[model samples]
Target: MAEEKFPINIWVNEERYEKLQTAGLADMCEEMLAGLKVIRVYANSAQRDKILQVFPTAKFDSATTKSIELLPREVKDAIFGKVVEKRSIDILEEFLGQY
Candidate 1:
């Protein structure tokens, strides 16, 4: 069976969109919420646990897309950076490794 992948939603502003565009990641942000573009980064359960431990404000919105939301801007930026750098959404392990 395929492994479960939990999502972490990152809202993209104009500046972030430009960066994503430059990185060729703009197309990945196909989802929109409240007029803002969004990219969903997938994480494993272990990574999600680490993230929740690291950022007490973060929560898993199981009712929605089963996404991890409410992360601080800086943390989101770091996750987005990993997305841009790797050109992929499967970045939770790498991002969590730092913490």
Candidate 2:
């Protein structure tokens, strides 16, 4: 049987983007898979807070924030991506595994 693959989609705004970029998340992904795309969206503080609550160890260079949600990847051969509202210490460590 052939192995299945899924496309990843990451949703984040400028503030969050900077955090991820600083942590080298985007760079890591690009290094592993070329031609990957990331989308940015505006998110209010409340929305950002909610996501941050789920990940208390996230770091932020600025007070501003954005919304992010990682869709579950349960279906075979279906495109999916994990959401990241903020760059937490744990998440950063996890991303390091790619190296």
Q: What are the per-model numbers of colliding residue pairs? A: 0, 4
> What is the TM-score of each predicted model, taking all chains together?
0.86, 0.27
Q: Which ten residues in a row have the lowest lDDT in candidate 1?
A: 29-38
lDDT for each candidate structure: 0.85, 0.36
Model 2 clash pairs are 58-88, 69-83, 70-82, 70-83
Q: What would the per-residue lDDT of candidate 2 be over residues 1-99, giving only the tens digit for each residue?
A: 643222222434455456567666654332223543454332345434543454455333244332234433231011112233342222322332342
- Please give the lDDT score at residue 85 for candidate 2: 36
lDDT of 1 at 50: 84
